[model samples]
Target: MEHVVRLEQVSSQLLAVVRRRAGVRELSKIVPEACGIVWNVVRAQRVAGAGRHVAVYLDDQINLEVGVEVSTPFAGHGEVIGSATPPGLTATTTHYGPYQRLHEAHEAIRQWCASNGYRPAGPNWEMYGHWKDEWNNDPTQIVTDVFYLLVADGSSS
Candidate 1:
């Protein structure tokens, strides 16, 4: 996919998440498991303004936070804890297609950063857009925004 990667500054966001450490190969399984648990908590708590599901990838070993957006930090239940994505400069892009092709957006950002002089700061996340029923008619209409935090100096730390 041709991603229109851009640099921007973002503020922190609160997420009710279940954290885990896993390899890339395990994401397909663990992500859903975590998201499901979080969703149950959000519903039971009636957390307001709960929004799209998010998967935050923290490091090389892949410390992960999978959950939905919450309005504020709350008393967490079990593994569903109050967590936040960092505020900083980032390389971001929007992907329009099926989730399976979402990785292409990440790759696009990585390549853009490499060629344009920037370094990943070890955390990246995917923010899934609210689903549209029409997407079932054309999976290519699905939307996801990908973000990679960048080092302050845009240099490898």
Candidate 2:
């Protein structure tokens, strides 16, 4: 599939995250569980705009933050911790398919960066859209946005 990679500025976002060092095999199990924990906390705390979910990859480990956008930050408790999504210039693309195929989107971004004289400056992340019933039957209906923080000067910082 053709991916349209674009450079855009992402604003800082509040996140409720669970940080862990695990291989790709463990992500399927860990991410969902973390999302559940975050959701429960959001409900209990009555956090507004609690819906969007994010999985941020910090190095080989994953810091999966599942929460909605909030106007302000909140104190973190237990496994649910408060953090800000990386904000700056980012190369982003949307992947339309099952989660298993997300790597293609990442690879496409990497290629786009290299060809355009840019490089990943920091951690990357994936923002998952609201789940729809149709998505269960049609994997292509699922949507995910992948972002890679870009080096300020198009070179290693």
Candidate 3:
């Protein structure tokens, strides 16, 4: 498993709301659909950051968190109707090929963290950098960035 950690500039976003009780199947159903709709109709760009953190957050909602946010940059004016921004400081990685294969990308990060003696922090995120459902006819061309926040020393896994 390869691992990289980096800092990101902070940003803000306006978001549409959706709520779901905690669980992978539930999240899987809700998030992909919401993101797909937002991507196809709204034409939003994918957010960047780490992957593991998002998974941990999904599994553990210690803090209030949003998943797979859709956004546009801040223009210092009234918020655009469909514009949005995700909180920054995420660990991000591009997982190519089918979206289902993203599970491996995430597993790589988790293994990297364990081998390196690092703990994951709060909830992480996944941003769809590119989704060309029409052209590719495969989710492989779909690019997703997953984020996992780091935990302090001696934290729980």
Name the top TM-score candidate: 1
Clashes of each: 0, 0, 23
Candidate 1 per-residue C-alpha lDDT over 44-127 given as tens digits, one digit per residue, 9 for 90 to 100? 989998989999998878898899998878679877899988889999999999887888999999999999989999899999
User: Which one wins on lDDT?
Assistant: 1
Q: Give the TM-score of candidate 2.
A: 0.91
Stretches of candidate 1 off by over 4 Å are 155-157
Query: Tens-digit lDDT track for model 2 on 57-147?
Result: 8764454455555556767767777887888999999999999889999999999988888889868988898889999899998999999
Which 10 residues in a row give candidate 2 its minimum summed lDDT? 60-69
Model 3 CA deviation exceeding 4 Å by range: 1-14, 36-58, 61-90, 152-157
lDDT of 3: 0.47
Judging by lDDT, tell me the better candidate of 1 and 3: 1
Error of 3 at 55 (Å): 9.7
TM-score of 3: 0.56
